[model samples]
Target: MREIVIGGAQMGPIQKADTREEVVDRMIALLQQAKGAGCDLVVFPELCLTTFFPRWYMEDQAEVDQWFEREMPNAATAPLFAAAREAQIAISFGYAELTPEGRHFNTSILTDRDGNIVGKYRKTHLPGHSEFDHDRAFQHLEKRYFEPGDTGFQVWRNMDAIMGMCICNDRRWPETYRVMGLQGVELVMLGYNTPSVNSQDSVEGLEKRLYHSELSMTSAAYQNATWVVGVAKAGDEDGHPLMGGSMIVDPNGYVMARAETEGDELIVHACDMDACSFGKSTIFDFARHRRIEHYGLICSQTGVVLPD
Candidate 1:
């Protein structure tokens, strides 16, 4: 039985005034807590280094690049890697990545116990508008600051488990998990910074958004027969309230642990790899029950035509 102790570290709001050193210290503090709890892995939320910068529309490229990290082990983040190495615990964290060619992507990196990078994933599903829209309560210009991830959904064998990653909106898409599920992923770690209010739909409230977050992750967990860890950067960020519903879901789609507050908190759970085998060998066994031949249209067509 490959049992892994997992820690979901949900962070509070990172105001614009917060410096990188301060944020890194907060992350290190969580790492220390996870270490104390005997956790084998810790997961932090997406774009954790700073306040959700996409909330503001910036015309200057230089101003936008300030939020992007040029290198992984730069001065500000070296402490995080050092702590993970010292504790011999694996870590998965998200950040804004600026490529050498000036391309920017919303990216996540997984590090082994020895502080070596195991794999990196760029966020494929980009949400929000690229241009400035005055109609919304706050601007969401992710489409303008970052490019759609070029890397397809990929899984890796790490920490004695088949792990996968996706960010934010990717959790809402079944295809994201299915692709990884097809590869025999046993656990998936993702991070999000979601606002409580929906700018696009006025009728949608915080309660509805929270419900959808839970529903999507739990459904994906059960359907894929994999454990899912979703960490959130919660609370109000620069006056915009973000939701704090970080949770860890088991293979049965049951939430094992969840954070109740919108702040820096850690929820640890021991996950048994054996739990996934039951579903994989039963109703969800793709090799035995799935009939791909009938679903060929999913790949053959981009859109479906409807009768008037």
Candidate 2:
């Protein structure tokens, strides 16, 4: 069995006026912390470089474009890549992307230990409405700002492990993990800018943000029998409060390390690859137990009714 060390970075607020350089510095500092802990890989939060800008209603395309990056390792972010190479650590980080092909996406990138761009995943399950509704306390206009992700859910082999990447809200969906698990995923990395304020129509659901967040990731971990590192960009970002629930969970559905506050912090854990074998061989063994052929009406049927 192989062993790897991972670091989860729970970052603080990103003020609306914060520059890209400032965020890079924070990321580099986290990288240094990971280095001190001898981490082979580190995970950063979704749209880690800027405020959760989508919360605002902006009509100008040019103004919106400012929040998205077109190039990786551009003048502003090169130092993060350089420092990672020097530290010999692979990293998975999320950012808002404005692609060369004229598409805007919420994307995540995987960089190998040698600092090479390995794989990129764009978020597919986009939540929130595009238009603003004043009836709700806040707007989660992710769907309005970001085009639905085209990459789909995917897993790639990197760092001697089958790794997967997804953005903030993607971790909440079970299929997000199952799609990659089919490819023999050993680890899943996610970054999120979750708001403590619940935007759901039901007022009662507001208090359940932390509960849903933890339950979502724990289910993903146990169902797939894989390690999951879900990082967050928390606290007040430009007056909007972001939820801070960064956690690292094992295959046994247990959280090994979790950050309780909204600040810059590091949680490192030594992960053994073989720890998931028992779960995989039993409950999650897809080849022997899965029934893919019967799922055709997955969307068409919501509940089963029995005659009284």
Q: In terms of TM-score, which candidate is strongest?
A: 1
- Look at candidate 2 and give me any clashing residue pairs: none
lDDT of each: 0.95, 0.89
Model 2: residue 187 alpha-carbon error in angstroms: 0.3
Q: Residues 71-131, candidate 1, lDDT per residue (tens digit)?
A: 9979999999999999999999999999999899999999888999998999998999999
Candidate with maximal lDDT: 1
Off by over 4 Å in 1: none
RMSD per prediction, one decimal?
1.1, 2.3
Residue-pair clashes per prediction, in order, are 0, 0
Worst 10 residues of 2 by lDDT: 198-207
TM for every model, in the order presented, reads 0.98, 0.95
Misplaced by over 4 Å in model 2 are: 201-207, 299-308
Residue 36 in model 1: lDDT: 99
